[model samples]
Target: MADTHENAYDEFAEAYAAMNETGSWNAHYERPATLALAGEVAGLRVLDAGCGPGILTQELTRRGATVTGVDASEQMLGLARRRLGGSATFARADLGKPLPFADASFDLVTASLVMHYIEDWSVPLGEFRRVLTRDGRLVFSTHHPTMDFHISGADDYFATYQFDDEWFHGDIVMKMRFWHRPLRAMTRALGEAGFGIDVIDEPDPEESVRESEPRAWESLSTKPAFLFFRAFPRYSA
Candidate 1:
């Protein structure tokens, strides 16, 4: 399949960066949960996969992790590079293919809200497992399958399929495609990719959003939009 999300992110890089800076519930929710699930990142080596404008990458660096950011979009990486300056390294890599890093190169890998764009998880998930040290943790978030299935009005939730959606921020609008897979399918994918799941969380909204973005908080507090998991490599990645 074509990489539509990468193009959308690239075309709307500036707008997406501004939205990420807003600290909205959607923008901020998964990061905090990923960090908490990760325990401590200080002094750890981190790879922020699908880094996108470097939001999570900068945070990992600020929290004292030696960080590297990777994305397919050079426009998005440009924003990340400008925001982080020399503090973090940014690279462009397609997640559908093999990653460039050596095996066990990272102590922790955080992929925030990126996986839904990929239809088949085997290669990308294997790549994540490959770069992680034996005991290193991977924390990632994706569009909740249930929620997407509901919105898609699909007859079979178990069937993996792609759908189109629009993202709006002020005057910037972008169309994107996302793949939806059932939880069991994801569990099977993880198992097949040589990783053991640690935590599966449908966490509450981040507290900061309660006052700053009450509507988003109200919507997200009761209905989780994203699903998160922490896993470690079980066999060879």
Candidate 2:
């Protein structure tokens, strides 16, 4: 049986990829900020956890990093492999499960806008630390915890729960379920997993969006919906 996250994307691989290419807020906002945070990627061994459709994975390879892209949904991985060709490796692996890589396999790890699909962070964050060299950095973007109310209209700010919402892709609207955890919970998990927080950023939307999609720019600039992080393994990578 497929889990919530797997089912959501597996049924609509091309639709999701199309959104990431053009319509989704991630296309204009989240992805660009993630790449910006990961400056100067030439020759870095990169592990792109939850690398849906390989968009960010492709960019990392373009910047000279050798990358491995992993996703839980085989359908998404299919699209990713087709897009990435041999520029990067593609694998079907769940981020919430034990990663297939050996210890200290990468110089950089990135998970772009994928964590909220997970209900628990401890194991995955631990795996991320284990696969990274001592000097390796982890960069990621996730939905802002503050937007739970907007996305689900939940009254309690501190409660953690699941919510389902309809998102449109061209003429298709799909129902997606994801967990909403408080920021404190995420930070605690990161600390317990042996990562030291290097940066916490509430970044603005990409500058081009301001001119091309003013409504999105204003909405995001006034009340951002994504949070970014840079973390390093503290004890040992």
Candidate 3:
């Protein structure tokens, strides 16, 4: 059987990709925030982990990063390959397992709204650290714990657990699962994986969305929809 973590994306790859292309939450909110955190990537070796549909990968490559995009869903990878067309390399790999890259293989690693799917951060995070150069950084975004707890209606904030939810894109609806852990737990996991946190951002929706997506702008501006982190490897002396 396929890993339950990845099956949902394969089922709605096309629909989700279409929606993500113009969706206010993705285009104006998460993607912009993530790219801002990445700063200048020209000439950097970037690994776009969980690079669904090549949306972020295309932008990274355009900004002069030699990117390698990886996703667990073949359907999504196919979409990515078609979208980029030899501009960047593509791979099929799961963040839940050891990444298929050599140590110090990349200058930056980016995971956009992908980490929440994995219940255990140890293996994936360690893999991120292992693949990144000494000076490299990992930039990622995920569903904010508080928001997820509210959406999940879970009683325990400190405990780590998976919750199921459904996503609607146009007329297509897909069920997905995500793991939720408290703020402390998230930071602790990163520290245990040898990453030193540099920035923890709770971004507001871009002003551009104010007129076009007023509701999204209002909600995201006032509440924490997602959390972003920029972390670097910390080696012991």
Candidates in order: C-alpha RMSD to true structure: 1.9, 1.7, 1.3
Candidate 1 residue lDDT tens string, 110-187: 888888988889998999998999889889989999889987788999999988888788777788889989999999
lDDT of 3 by residue, 1-237 (tens): 033445999988899899889989999999999999999999999999999999999999999999999998899999999999999999999888988799999999999988898878898899999999999999999999999999899999999988888888767778888889999999999999999999999888878899998998889888899999999999999
> Pick by TM-score: which candidate is best?
3
lDDT (C-alpha) at residue 190 in model 3: 99
Question: Rank by lDDT, descending?
Answer: 3, 2, 1
Runs off by more than 4 Å, candidate 2: 1-6
| Rank list by TM-score | 3, 2, 1
In candidate 1, which residue pairs clash? Answer: none
lDDT of each: 0.87, 0.87, 0.92
Clashes (N, CA, C under 3 Å) per candidate? 0, 0, 0
**lDDT at residue 219 of model 1 (Cα atoms):** 81
lDDT of model number 1 = 0.87
Model 2 lDDT at residue 75: 87
TM-score of each: 0.95, 0.95, 0.97
Q: Model 2 over residues 1-237: C-alpha lDDT tens digits?
A: 133643888888888898888853877788888998888899999999999899899889999999999998888899988998888999889887899999999999999978888888887899999999999999999889988657888987687888887888778877888778888988898999999998999988778888888888889889969899999889752
